[model samples]
Target chain A: MTASSALPYQRLHVELDARRYPIHVGPGLLDDPDMLVPYLAGQQVMIVTSETVAPLYLERLKHALSGDGRDVREIVLPDGEHTKTLASVERIWDALLAAGFNRRCTLVALGGGVIGDMAGFAAACYQRGVAFVQVPTTLLSQVDSSVGGKTGVNHPRGKNMLGAFWQPRAVVIDTRTLTTLPARELSAGLAEVIKYGLIQDVDFIAWLEARMSALRALDADALTDAILRSCAIKAEIVAADETEQGQRALLNLGHTFGHAIESHQGYGNWLHGEAVGAGMLMAAALSQRLGWLEPDEVLRVEALIAHAGLPVTAPASMSGDDFLSIMRLDKKNIDARLRLVLLSRLGDACIHDATPSDMLDALLTDFPRR
Target chain B: MTASSALPYQRLHVELDARRYPIHVGPGLLDDPDMLVPYLAGQQVMIVTSETVAPLYLERLKHALSGDGRDVREIVLPDGEHTKTLASVERIWDALLAAGFNRRCTLVALGGGVIGDMAGFAAACYQRGVAFVQVPTTLLSQVDSSVGGKTGVNHPRGKNMLGAFWQPRAVVIDTRTLTTLPARELSAGLAEVIKYGLIQDVDFIAWLEARMSALRALDADALTDAILRSCAIKAEIVAADETEQGQRALLNLGHTFGHAIESHQGYGNWLHGEAVGAGMLMAAALSQRLGWLEPDEVLRVEALIAHAGLPVTAPASMSGDDFLSIMRLDKKNIDARLRLVLLSRLGDACIHDATPSDMLDALLTDFPRR
Candidate 1:
């Protein structure tokens, strides 16, 4: 159960009965078709990827999958949050049916969080739910989006506004795919890595703080260890609460505030990890205001976010009322009442049904207009 | 249990843990707000109806639900098979979001199969999945679509080619709603009513043959009894095999051939139930040709379809090749193999892995060129 002992390898199973699947985390896991082929279910495979990742790793992945009897097809979507729309989802469906993908076929999502979410949503609806595999190529996807069964496309009105919580048959994380990722993207992925620590893993957070430099330097050992730990934590949480009824809300530590920023700033304006970083800072500041955390503890959270090269403050143009309005529409809100997943302390979080007035007041003070 | 004593007034449950819900069938169930309130889960309810049903029953259902102290909203879609599309689905999503419907809201589909499918798909994708209730107003929906939890909009390329199997919290089938149904629409619904009998209910077929006249006349008792019996059978099948692995495919008895005819003649050109009516004859003929069914049995199916005022023959315009190509893309087809559910006898069905060449030959003979 210890991080080191569990490192360098471990398989976490998501027990959804017949739909049960495993998340394999380690170096070079993606190259092994044996890890994925068992779940293929049929001969036809469609690997949904992005323009950016196509040139780098799509060919290798395609080669590996098509090496045997598998008839692999690839559809490259435009890279970015902009492509997560109804139009894009329709295109994926068209390509899938065009390729004669029957209900037995599998859809393989081969990129970051956007690809996984969009592809998974497409799979969930294509012929009323087909099996899908998550070959998450980004650190953020590998650690978070890939582990959770949540998949969806963004609507013009909201991010991830249209989707399903369809768990993938398997998630293949090849840490080597990160070699070509941009520095900013890598840092954004670390934001989620840092979140696991801030929300429920004090020991892991301590370890992350110690290995921050090594991770930034793209040390294979550091990256793999972080991913393994993140997936394990997420797997445990999701297994307990498949849907966000109770404890699963804890995983949305920064997401309520983060979604507001994402929607207000326009999706793709801030990388999800960046918005989450700033959102976590806001949560920490609010926790400090409520006397749940020491002011110094709030500073530590902000410092870690800043050190990871993520935004620690809200965007300048967002007003308190604007943030509150956007957050109120968040799916987490019940009966129009805003619910925030606030940390009681580092490594411990609770869902707070904060009054709108209190939330707005806290947001106003923490992110005051200049 | 005897048919009348078999819980004539009881609720049938589709057990899926937290997602489990009941299907209440009987006279006067629609006015009971208590039956619908528990599933609402929130104060905001959006009732998706059609131009046809809105003028008749929307207000009554709204009033019934209003007793629970919740805000009720209704979106009236154009009344027809043509309205089941991405465009209409987007409108439903837009209306829900515009009216401030968050994840906590419930969508009540208060029309026939088209509205139920489109509205259900909209709910499935709305914030990754929300609760929906089926208030199927047509004979087709009451007996079939409303009970099984299969929901989706149709694509221009195919009927129900785009959808999700998102279960509803409950189904409210008001047999009174069929009182205003046109003679043609009523007969169209009978196509499905006959389907249950063809696949696995010889006794139901005999009952329908004996009572077809009274049911067509919209006799209150006969219609309600038939709807309840069909729904009970569908509920049991769906409960055992939610995803159509084996037994569920039996329910698609005439759908494969019916979908081809509908797609070939153009989506709205043929009433879905009409096409299925004719398609069932072709499947029966093919079953007889394959020595699985007797010629007399095929004649019996054809006679019942004709008695129900449905076409038991293919239209002159469609070609065998066109029908073959369309059936090839059916979701049920595994790999390039065309797997169809064909009747071996009156009360049993088997998944036949028919060769494409043989099926094409059968199509050519059944729908000979002009």
Candidate 2:
């Protein structure tokens, strides 16, 4: 084992009734059976990963999950945000049924957010829900998507239009996996880590500003700390609102605008985190217009996003009308009101369904484009 | 409105803590706006029905759910068990998104088991679940699938393999709809009605034996009583075990073999209740071999199923091997052990995972065929 592999892990729990699970973050959790095995529902284990991740870590994950006389299987799906669909989830279900995996089977999702969402969704609907564990191999999933039980696939009409609130039995985040993540992807993940600070932790924003360089350099401590703090904040919010009925919508601070970009640009083009980074800036700008954030706070948000190597501007091709069209279809919206998570202040986010169309149009039309 | 429209509805609650819902049974309940509107989650109501039932009742249901300025919409899917698919469910999600239905929007399932299961499964996963109500138009759904939250579509390899346990806001069973149901479907529905008696209540079995003619003839009073009793039994069981941990398996008394038959026969060829009818008899015969039921008891089970006009024999084309292969894939099995619910006695069912291979083989090999 490498010297980095011996780093001690930190564990956090998402305190959900009956569905409570642990989030284990460290340098080499992928190789630790003790971290993954106890969470398995039964003898059956299905490791659902993407083609991009299989060669890199699938075997080691299987190795860690092996030797318990378990029936271990793997399904390598094509990777990318566009591939997040019911058809992809069906393939996972098909593989499990083909393998004769039952309700007691556990699905271990071993890739980034797309893989985690699709595999976790498959586990949710497979035989009316089975236990699943998240072995997120990307920084984005490790810090954000993997921590929550939100599992679903995107629809042609909107992102995450089809899914379930299926919590994982455990979340295993091995910081070593980040070393294999491309710099752009790591930056995408940093967007969500930044989101935690922007939404609920102002001090975390300062902490991130200090450590952005180290995080970009793949410093183990910096990345691990970011993941732990981000998860802790998310775990608390998700525990309060497991179904996104209320406070949990705060997590989608930039997601309303981000999803529109993703949907309009077509999934995978901008990457969810990249779009979210830009969307967060748009939200901050809107918050400024609403007097919720100072002009300096908006600049701080932009500086942080740019420093993290994320996009600071919306896609040039998207029009104000385009944003409204796609944003109208957002799942967060209830009835005729379009709900967007905005900053009431730094370190505090609020769901706003009463945004005036003219103000939103001005922001979308006036927002800087790439 | 018909005189039967004045029939007082009986309400039964499936006590599932926060997810608990009521099942209302009576004739002409569909035309009563009071029955459906109160259960809807919001002003946006999406009515999911089949082409077969749309011409007959959609207008009335819409009228009842309208006038309150509710944006009630409808999607008429092609009817049949073959159409019970993720693709069909995607169409539902697509329609919901197309209509801009939000998280609080309600999906009203307005057909038989196939429609109820598909729409409920759609609601279970649409934006991670929305409120839904069951407006069951057929007997099978009214007494069974609509009461419990076991909603899903069948896979090519298995029946109801992909789904979730999402309870409905209410179940509105209008006995008047059964007046237009085909004679064959009425028999199919009776199979499940008979199952409730066979699994847990011998007195109900005797009561059914006396009332079978009345039920088959569509006697409103007899039908309502059967519906109420069946739903009460299902509600009690589902309340105790919402996710089918232990006692819920008793409800699947004939479903293991039934699903095998359905899968082998190709879904939609034999109605789900028809397959269950024959499968229940098979379970009885197997129970006799296991010395749990006397030969006369097996005959009584056969007589009841046959009297209900359901098949008393397995399909002529299927072999012992076909049944074995399919039954081996039953979801109730765990860790390579095949679990089947068999009769412990009249009105009492037991889950058996230890039936001797030779005995199961002999029963399968010697079982009567059409």
Candidate 3:
């Protein structure tokens, strides 16, 4: 019990000049209008969420967003990562036009990463861009996806191949929502939370290791602390590089290989964070091979990922060639060069595009498979 | 021949802070790599054109774009206004990813408005946006779409219902391409060129009246002069209001009513500029009813549209109610009020959200149907 018990919420800002926005982490934030209404671009508010999330939180959010002047509407899309497509976003744009929503309309994304990414992309292109608020529900979104403003849908050839770097007006994260999240989803989110520790904060990694059990058990303080720290690390890095021109690529610590898994398995087959969990292990192993990370460091990464209930190895069906083929299309690669973010040590990461192909082939071929 | 024959090209810049770019109006620019290569973001270039224009200019443009270390690929889409959909943009994204084009790649839009719009939008979202240049061949594109950076596709619900305000790196308008254009398209292009005059340039309107015949007959000097003046005016307005927030809406003087006609008739059935031509006459007539214009002024507008060989009346299939319903959902409308960009006087326009429903009803009902 600390001041968090009395305050009940923690707030942080992503410093992006005129586009800067706040991320609020707490319990029971879904029912609070104060955290949302101020950031809306205008009176037209459209809440976009998935079928899985609407029943759990829609009415409460609608009530919170309701006002004398505001016009509130919602579209309940089918659930799952497979639904993250241009067609779903088209449905949003169609509804907006049908409802006569205009340039001043604000989109409120009220689900997990799939919902947030799709809703944010819809807002980015709607009327040549409008305002949107992210009311992210799931641990993965609360910690990572909801903060960076990386919004888009996956293509058949790749995951998140089509997207825009459109920032949100605000992010409202409710720890209470995690209470209803499936155990697998909660663990999936922990992968990204652990990623923050592995990439930039060694101390935070130790902190997460000690408190992983408490977080899994739905301990409010632990969840709030974890989300706040993860978002702060993200906000800092994003502030330094808003468009992924430089340091921002470091945040994709395991995403290149992770995206390959997601794209190959079909988007909805594997959870994003789950794919990233195994990807982080692969990155650590490769770093050790490069003499940048110790063998013991790789083991610690695997152990933490395992403790988080995330996959520690690649899918068995995917061969080295499949991974290489899919990874070749990762958005991070420039001018035909494959770039990977690898751990130089426990607390730091570097983007290396000069890895020896034979060494990469050996790692992909010999790496443990589940 | 004037000074035009001496230089062969005229240069103007759209001042958008750091995003400022040039608009080059000339004949035979397709074979001049010097006009394009300087703006290329990298060695990778994807040329997106329509099938109709590919046979005419694709190889010539490719020859010019070809150079040491440059990688150029082309995707020629099926042509037409109806083909403007997310599906087309997806195909563009598919080809770019297939080629492993990176963030540094540049997309060259090598056709009319439809091609420029789709290519520009694909560039806006590919790998979270890459650089793109406008190689607009049609007169309408050279003078309007290529200059303003209003890139998008029409939705089933409305025209240009999906898009982004992604500016191009440069606009290369080759007057010679107009030689291959159909007579109807040349007239359609004139409708937009006429719009610039009616909206902001009284002198240009007078100049156009004197030389409409020369423009229609493809007098190179007259065409070049018309394109330069139109682009210069559009660039000034766009620079002042990049997004259609305030003064920019003035640019849509006939567009609100024009879009209604396009939507009602289906996009491809009516050329955008033809619908706008008839729509502009409707606007002038409505202005007369409001006591803003003389009856002679209305006739003058009608004659100009007729002189351009554009439709001067609404589609026969559309009823006033049909127009009203579609106009209700126009992006410019706010709070259920229908906003119309009406001529306050010749060469000037205003966005009137308070148009009495009865007056609009009368105009829609009394306006002649073709």
> lDDT winner among the candidates?
2
- Candidate 2 or 1, higher TM-score: 2
Q: What overall lDDT goes with each candidate model?
A: 0.83, 0.91, 0.90
Error of 3 at B207 (Å): 2.5
Cα lDDT tens digits for candidate 3, A57-103? 99999988998678999999998877888889989999998987888
Look at candidate 3 and tell me the lDDT of residue A125. Answer: 93
* True lDDT of residue B124, candidate 1: 89
Worst 10 residues of 2 chain A by lDDT: A1-10
* Candidate 1 pairs with clashing backbones: A163-B128
Q: TM-score for candidate 2, please give it.
A: 0.95
lDDT per residue for candidate 2 within B1-370, as digits (tens), equals: 4444476989889999988788888877888877877788888989999999999999988988897688999999999988988899989988988887888899999999899999999999988999999999889998989988989998877678899999999999988999899999999999999999999999999999899998888888999999999999989998998888999989998898898898888877898889999999999999999888999889988998989999999999999999999888777888788999999999999998999999999999999999
Task: Categorize the docking of model 3.
Answer: medium
Cα lDDT tens digits, model 3, B1-370, are 2233354688999999989999988888878878888899999999999999999999988988888779999999999988999899999999997887778999999999999999999999987889999999999898889987788888776667788889898998889999999999999999999999998988999999999999999999999999999999999999999987788888787888888888877777889889889988989999999999999988988998899999998888899999998888887886667888899999998888877889999999999997
* Distance from true location, Cα of A273 in model 1, Å: 1.6
Instruction: List TM-score per model, in order.
Output: 0.93, 0.95, 0.92
| Per-residue C-alpha lDDT of model 2 across residues A1-370, encoded as one tens digit per residue | 3344466999899999988889999988898888888899899999999999999999999988888598889999998988998889888988998887888999999999999999989999999999999999989999989987999988777678888999999999999999899999999999999999999999999999999999999999998899999999999999998887799889998998998898889778888999999999999999999989999999999999999999998989999999998888776777778889999999999988788889999999999997
Report residue B336 deviation for candidate 3 (angstroms): 1.0
